[model samples]
Target: MKTAEEKKTRNTKHQKAVLELLKNATKALTADEIREKLADNINKTTVYRMLDRFVEAGKIHFVTGQNGKSFYALCKSCKEEPPKHIHNHLHFQCEICGKVECLPETLKVPQLDNYTIRETQLLLIGTCKRCMNSTN
Candidate 1:
């Protein structure tokens, strides 16, 4: 357990980063992006540790990438966005570009009725439009 000051500091830092990245991000980004943006000020270990808290706090979501590392993004704000979150939007992972995007208007993830739903994540692997068009 951390002290109150520590917890507060952690919350402020993580929340700021989460919102900053989410608002600017087109899709999900890996820890590498975070480190790149913040540099030495944001240690990789700190990012991972803070990510855990953000996930638990329902501020962020995670998905597995082709590289096997867990990619993360800002959680769909249950308030402004549709409740169909968790796994609502289908993911589009670019093969050549190696970018993961949340296809909001695309994949319609089924919402299971019954029982409590805790977390949801989806992965759609394919070549992105940019990559596909480039191939042709």
Candidate 2:
């Protein structure tokens, strides 16, 4: 039987692998995309669960595509307390290629007197430079 420490180590290893995949990705990726790149064959359900855990832990954020498909990206400004994750950044989706990328800039959240904002997602859709250049 595996000891508690061994099990924790195994779990951490898997989590690190998943995080590494997201960190290296230039574009947001679906669970399938992440799974395809992993060296080990991790279960689809496990991938989804890991994604959820990461989101809750403020390590990543999810963006829903125009077609309703969800993609995950790493949170560049994650914090441990107060605001666990920052969602002020904008996401750009290439309408032609259906690729999603996180822009380096951030948007200011409007202040409401009696409202507490949990998160905000802004998705901008357009033909990316690569696609536009390719068409010429």
Candidate 3:
């Protein structure tokens, strides 16, 4: 087993890279994009592996696009030392530009007394105002 400091160090490195990539992104990105951003410093396989680990660790989260591609983004708000993206937030995908936008602090998922709720995936796809207005 690894020591606490070792784990922290690893997490710090992962979070650093994730935030750096997100800081420069206007929309969500796939593991390949992340690998491209990191260049030869890391490979595509390792980027995917790191993404999985970060998602599990709550440092990053996934959102699916209209094209069915999985993209990642940093949480708007995070808990724990490294911070985790809230899973209950809304994800909006613009059909025109293919931008994935997160609508957080909007709504808390509803719970039913008799319902055994596990998880939810909601994606609202449409042309954004910018796109729609541009057509006119």
Judging by lDDT against the true structure, name the best candidate. Answer: 2
Error of 3 at 57 (Å): 0.8
Candidate 3, 14-62: lDDT as tens digits: 6577678876777778877777776346656667777888777766778
Clashes of each: 0, 0, 1
The residue pairs in collision within model 1 are none
Task: Please give the ranking of all candidate structures by lDDT, highest first, separated by commas.
Answer: 2, 3, 1
Model 1, span 24-131: residue lDDT tens: 888788887877776236667877877887777666777888889787777564443223334555676887998987766544445568865555567878888888
Better of 1 and 3 by lDDT: 3
The reply for model 1, stretches above 4 Å from the true place, is: 1-11, 80-85, 105-116
Ranked by TM-score, the better of candidates 1 and 3 is 1
Model 2 lDDT tens row, 92-120 = 99999999988888888888899888777
TM-score ranking, best first: 2, 1, 3
At residue 124, give the lDDT of candidate 3.
83
TM-score against truth, every candidate: 0.73, 0.86, 0.71
